[model samples]
Target chain A: MFDDRSPIYQQIANGIKDEVLSGTLKEDEQIMSTNQYAAFYRINPATAAKGFAQLVDEGVLYKKRGIGMFVSPDARGRLRAQRRERFFADVVDPMLTEARMVGVGVDEIVAYLKDGAR
Target chain B: MISLRDLTVRYGDTVAVDGITLDLEPNKIYGLLGRNGSGKTSLLSVLASYRRPCAGTVTIDGVDPFENAALMRATAFVRDSLDVTDQDRIAKVLDFAGRLRPTWDAGYAEHLADVFELDRRRRVSALSRGQRSSLGVVLGLAARAPLTILDEVYLGMDAGARAAFYRELLADYLAHPRTIILSTHLIEEVAGLFEQVIVIDRGRLLLHEDTDTFRARGVAVTGPAAAVEAFAAGRTVLGEQSLGGVRQVTLYGALADHEAEAARTAGLTLAPVGVQDLFVHLTAVGDTARTEALR
Candidate 1:
């Protein structure tokens, strides 16, 4: 289910982040153990552990010592803030660039967006 | 840790494994890769102590493994041509392994046999190719040795059977961590399971590094022929192909961020190359000519 564009660990971290943002994983919810994640994804447990470690480092997830991992209380808000910081450059800028290339004016795009909003 | 210092293996005049030095830390899965006749088996043989190194030395935790009772007993090496008696039933073969290997788990072995749907009453000779491979998986995983070397033990397994084997292997390994070395041609299928990858070519060490690092090494740049050529200039090109006005070149190194941005501005698409493609290009015959032509 993963791709070669990036390391599998990065993908795993991003996948968990996406789940958090989408509310599939609620804040303070207990998540699967690294072993379970590795088994489900058919990946090395070490790789899965690396991904979890990254999330822990980023404050997106927290460990319970002898227990399991839980989503950070502020993880969703923090992730949303991070994605908002890059939304224009990563998503809107490219859309605008493609629109400019195809001779689509900003007014037309605005009109379409307004129509969708209505 | 397992250390090999300038190890070599030879058969008569033919050198199967050239002088190579490597250190394997305990409790990690290593994928051993090589083309046929490239000495992968010989290297594994030396590691498993099935055959002594022609030169150099092999030590496990500061002691030689060859003929060492304790060390050898703690290492399980299962190959395609199993070392079991053809006339023995599957149950008997497993019983023999349990008796010899101190780490063998009979309960786990029985579970694996059920997972593979193997009939324990059937003789080894009567089993199908796929079944034999499954039996090998059972023996290798259930042994749970400190060092387990599976040299193409998946030879005759079908895709489904192989999937089960991979799952079982990973699950068991998680439960009981050990040093696992798998030598196989199925790079893409098994690449994810390897913490580190060791590739050998022509009886010599090609590359050994973290699996993620190795995966990041190969990049495929695709775009207009001239643009692709310009971007590929001064880079190590592993392989390339052209169709009409579009050209794609597989490169042997990761691109710098600025370089990637420049390629994007120039309308070139950079794609990651899979481990299998990288392995094929890296070990392809007559590599110099292909690389030289690009330069």
Candidate 2:
């Protein structure tokens, strides 16, 4: 859920992203309030709010003034797009680095990713 | 800026701050968070010019706070106790502050008194512990010092009051930015208010980092003991607990997506580590290690 090297808000953002991507969350669905998330997770509401705000900023969520944060209509797509953009930088680089160390070439790495996708 | 170089304080047999060096800048609200007996009060005392650091140098804007009248005048230190004599009435203390603090706004202080329903003529000695805490908060805010240090000033306040205080503190800080160092045990509650945070554990600096950077630093993994151990190999495991094959470990590092995926593939459940839990893991490990971390 968290690490000494990643911001808490980012972890929260990732958690919410998981829900959205998994279809547990829905388009235009009102997500839990900051206080609700905070109480449920036993974290500071501010921390939760920051996470929600980050999602809002990224267009994965939107605020309904005085109501609560709601998953955007295109939330899943938005997150998928953002994550896809960073996938290579975040995922592929390390994979390639690790693969190269083990004498696994680009073709083998590509084959493994293809297998995983299937 | 507030600077403490090799600061040390001793009270009888107790050594408070032991060779600490910290440079804190202005215009940011910092949470000077630590456990009890961590010398937070003593460090703030020296910074606020309320007490002299036994050894080392403490300077605010190039002036040693100890007995430095002008520097002390610009600083406000609010502890549960601010050395206000029991003989004085709460009103007198407010009145004294109103006169003494160059930035003191009497109207605002009176307004705070009204908000807290603090009776002016009531003796400070007769006040309840809760009320005393309220008074301390009142004085701290009303003083309006450039460097305002609140040392456990939220102790006696109820939940609602504490929430109100946080909101007002934030609002006030937003409106009139100043250097505020809040020393408290409520890490999660007030962690948001901090731009930069310094955690002193048992008279040592365990952590001093931007709130974002600090939060960016650790994670917990739960899984079978073998896989968990394997995943945690070459990583700093802050804490580990195992029951039969079920293992839970808190690791210190920036967890990347591949790392999380790796942990998942290795049959581990990734979880976020709480700052309080991290502090416990880091400090409870031992005095020697933590002390070295502080220096």
Candidate 3:
């Protein structure tokens, strides 16, 4: 199911990226056709197609003429690399900001993380 | 393409659909929304050529649809009121549509009947409201007309049945592309299916744009009353509510990326309003439309 947080097509594109990251959709694996995707998600075919188009543009997926879309051979690695690059800014920075706002010291946070690792 | 030139429809002293001009492209699903007595049905009736407009024109593929046998054959308008006899069976009703519709697919009709679990031998009079609605869905989808309009045919269907209908409709539409217009009050349920949406209020065109744009045009900013008011100042406030110093104001415009970031920093929650909430605020009684009219 989709939410109104962002455009449905963007959500669809992100969903495919997540699948690639999670290894649920293997590299070079044939993915659902836009029509099938649209029906499965109960969204407009055009919207689903737009999402696939976005993935293709991002080099995350490739299309086989007269066939369907497949995950790019480097899709998983590429996604992981991209997420890694943004991890500090998108994930870590936000957490640090929230922690600072709550007056949680970095030392205490590190201790808790080390304890959880045990 | 279908074009409407200053179309107007009247019944006695009641002006159902006031003068309105618009164009609807082919092979796209359009969601039409309007409040009760806001001329949604009358406008659809004219577009479907079920009734002649008192003034102006409606052209289908650059030709008049009224009394044009060729054009009529290519258009299917199915509403909740089943056009079959109460004493007749469901099979009889579908047979009549198949004979009349030039593009009718009997196989698909039968398939849809199975999907809806419709009893073909059951009399129309004995069918429940939901069953009758299912029959309407069969007729509309199986007709496969170039111009198919379904006017709230899911009136009596349960949530599961409605979900099935949406699935069937999207699948069939992908298989056979055509111009389809759906008029419904279930904005949240099916808004995603529409490529474009047309909203009318008080017999006037309120808005017609891509569904995505229509939804993105509004944002709900919620926070402390003073900050919310400051953020909403100089913006079109479509609706607002306040509870215990927390205020939420729905603004009718886009929120730029920087502005959204600023709002976040300012501790304001900038949320996107769903199509249904937007529609309610757009056409609710004594809402923006009435205020505009009064001004």
**TM-scores of the models, in the order given:** 0.95, 0.73, 0.94
- Poorest stretch of ten by lDDT in candidate 1 chain B: B286-295
What is the per-residue lDDT of model 2 for residues B1-295, given as tens digits with 9 covering 90 to 100? 8788989999998888888898998777888877888889888878877777889998777777778778778888888776698889998999888877789978878877777778999999998877888889889988888888899988778887787677667666655678888898787676666777898876777778877766656688999888888898888777788888899988876788998988888878988777667667666635565346334
Where model 1 places Cα greater than 4 Å from the true spot, the runs are B288-295
State the lDDT of candidate 3 residue by residue for B1-295, as single tens digits: 9999989999999988888888999999999998777888899999888899999999987999999999888889987787779998988998988887779999999999999999899999998899889999999999999999998899889998998999999999999989999998888899889989998887878788888778787799999999998888887788999999999998887888898988988899988888888888888786655436422
What is candidate 3's local distance difference test score?
0.89
The number of the candidate with the highest TM-score is 1
Give the alpha-carbon lDDT of every model.
Answer: 0.91, 0.79, 0.89
Residue pairs whose backbone atoms clash in candidate 3? none
Flag the better candidate by DockQ, 1 or 2.
1
Ranked candidates (TM-score, high to low): 1, 3, 2
DockQ, ranked from best to worst: 1, 3, 2
Best-matching candidate per lDDT: 1
Clashing pairs in 1: none
